[model samples]
Target: MNSLTAFARPVLRWGGDPSGGAPYVFADPSDPQTYTGFDYEFAEALADKMGMQAQFVPTDWESIVSSLKRKEFNVIINGFEPTGDRAREMLFSKPYYLFRLQLTVRKSDGTITSLEDCKKYGKSVGTLVNCAASRLLEEGKYRVKGYQDPVGAYEDLELGRVDAVLMDVAGEMFYARSNPKLKPAGKPFQTGAYVVGIRKADASLKADIDKAIDELINDGTIEKIFRKWNLWDDEQVKLRTATPPAIEITTTKLNWSEGLIKLFKAAMITVLLAFGAMFIAVILGIPLAVGQSNGGPLIRALCTTYIEFFRGTPVLVQLLFLYFGLPVIGITLPGWLTAIVGLGLNYAAYESQIYRTAFQAIPERQWQVAYSLGMRPILAFRRIIFPQAFRIALPPMTNDFVALFKDTSTAFAIAVWELATAYRELANATQSYLGIGIVVCCYYLAMSLPLAHYAHRLERKLQRKSTGILSSGAEK
Candidate 1:
């Protein structure tokens, strides 16, 4: 029965990010269980024209192309621009929708009115990462901040975090248009068209999608979809007659050495964020652990509550709250600083548990021995109790430090641009995910393996010292 059902209706899987929101693919605010957008309508129409059932596969916008390459979906129907770098990695169908760059700024910002003004004044512009607008900003040497989505960039613009936002006109239409605080700074520029992306090996699928797109255009179906979404304009009529502007293939060869250097720099950021966060974790963890182990009821309750609250919530949410939510309260932290503080606070909970357990594991005899030797409580704790507890906690602490390296990838959410972000950007640009991924893995292993090995050796050496000390005490 399953086989027959599969044969009866072949599925054309198209992928996109609904979080990108509105006019492209998004949850219908009126009915979120179903998606509604020009892209969604077009996908359904294209699939129907091809005698197949449409299946929408939700994917992150950053890894959409890579997801297509992985065969997670049959085609990418997201707002993918045909670039030479992308063309080398995949086949592009006939242009589906015309698009151009729109610059948006806060209504009160009179200092920056246009892209030229942004450039002349050295203003910061925000755009989606790894997209054409970001590349254009980079080429023009403007201060550019990249967000995971258009909405984020627009939000930052409204918050005055960015002087302007340069993104696709569609982004402005859906996000900035409704916001009374933001206005289009200048006329749209940089004409481009959205195209469906298929894997390079899927020539037959490409041909079929192209045929379907042509049919949709010829039959006025595409126009109807655009009109329904209020996206139809004089510019889109050109899609019927005009070929998409030629994709300029970059002639300059990719410098693997340069790419490696960039990845190395990003890896260093990962290291620094991890180290800084872990340092904070250790500093705070010790106090919390000590408080919980030996303090009044109030102190113990506070420490326990702090530990439980941070441990229960996800680190990503904490980071987002620190970076985005805090800005609402006039507490704006830089991305890297927020990442460090967020991760530190989250991990300190676990670290405190580790320390508390180690503290408990120490026999009462140790304390009695220190007191018998006439050592003060503080001196005994510093010289004997802490040293012993620290040794017991060392292995786990090292393990947590190693894990922190990978967790630093979450910094990408707040735009710290750590090793993981570097890998994604490089992989997308070079279309060499396998090679770049292996290099990134090697970089992580390089950072982690040494510490792990040293921790093991130190643990064994400490065990030996401990055993020898016991033997000496017995002999004495």
Candidate 2:
């Protein structure tokens, strides 16, 4: 028996994003352990047709294709549209379900009645990053904001952050259609089809899946699954009679120059965010460290509490709360500012600990000597204690700054397109994950290696200066 034979593998593992939510694979509300959705049911049927049991593998929507490439699963059965870019990376089975683009806007908005209106008024439309809808908006030169999922895009629409959200009709059916505050701005447009993605090496499995899909369509099993989730429509009937559209292979070369330009811009954003947050961390952290080190018990306790709270929690959770949770109490900040504040505040806790340790490392005689020289407490701190502590803390602070550059990637959770996001988008577009990833690494190294080198030099220089001063003092 071949490896692709059902007897060889009793379980067919399919990857999808449960968080992509309904009409796609999502956790069943009644039983959170089990998943439900048209896609979920359809996958089960597909597996059964292949004489195997269906096993669902939860994956993030953004990296689902890459996960498939890594052989994380046997196939990807998510709401994957067969686009030219994706066609280059994986072999797709015949199209299973027809889909369309849906534009959702707030109920109170009268200005944007359609996609054209959004373009005419220059309103920002939110969409899943690197998806067909985003590509559509980009092609039209419309203001586009990319979200990781439809839920965030729709939430932003309701919160008035984005004027409208463009996504698949399947997502709209679950996320936007039921919300009273939101309405479809126009009829769904732009026809497409969802296809199962299989690795190129899995041609046998692809052939098996294609045959199963044809059988399922002919036997009406696919329609039955769709009807269970209220997803059945006239558009699906065409799947039986019509041959799945040929996967368009674009002959154009990957635009390395344009991709590099985008990466450079995004790298600059990463730099700006890292530096801005580091500035805030330094400004806030010094006082926090000082208060904790020198203040009375009550002040020390408060600082300790803040430091513990921020340090103990994950930075990604803090960012999500700052961007999504804050708006619940009527506080809303833009994505960029929120990213800065979130990263800065979280890093401040660590920075405080570093400074506190540095302060403790300074000998008590330094303060006494400054006092003996008739220096006030503030002057003594500035001229003696602080200068030495700063030297002691500089290396670690530089390390944190470098780490903060990487942490800036977490900003993508809140929709800020930093270098990592750019790289992912470029990989998605060009299907050159390794090459683009290497280029992105070089960009980060370009930004961080110089800073790291400078910090090392400065630390050595400071050590030499300190040794010279001690030598002079010993001679005196």
Best prediction by TM-score: 2
Weakest 10 consecutive residues of candidate 2 by summed lDDT: 467-476
lDDT of 2 by residue, 63-160 (tens): 88888888889998988877777777679899898888899999999899899998888899999876778777766768888888888998888888
lDDT per residue as tens, model 1, 1-476: 36575578889999999996577899988897999787888899999899888999989888888788788999988778777667766898988888888999899988877898998998998888767777677567688777888877887787777789998888788888889999898788887878898889989988998888889999999989888877788988777775654443222134789789989999999999999999999999988988988889999999999998898988998998898899889988778889999999988999999998888777777888999999998999999888888788898899899888889999988877799988887776667789989999999999999989898999998887682223222221
C-alpha RMSD of each candidate structure in angstroms? 3.8, 3.8
Clash totals in order: 0, 0
Model 2 clash tally, residue pairs:
0
Instruction: Give per-residue lDDT, candidate 1, residue 114.
Output: 83
Work out the TM-score per prediction: 0.88, 0.90
lDDT of 2 at 356: 90
Compute the lDDT of residue 47 as modeled in candidate 2. Answer: 90
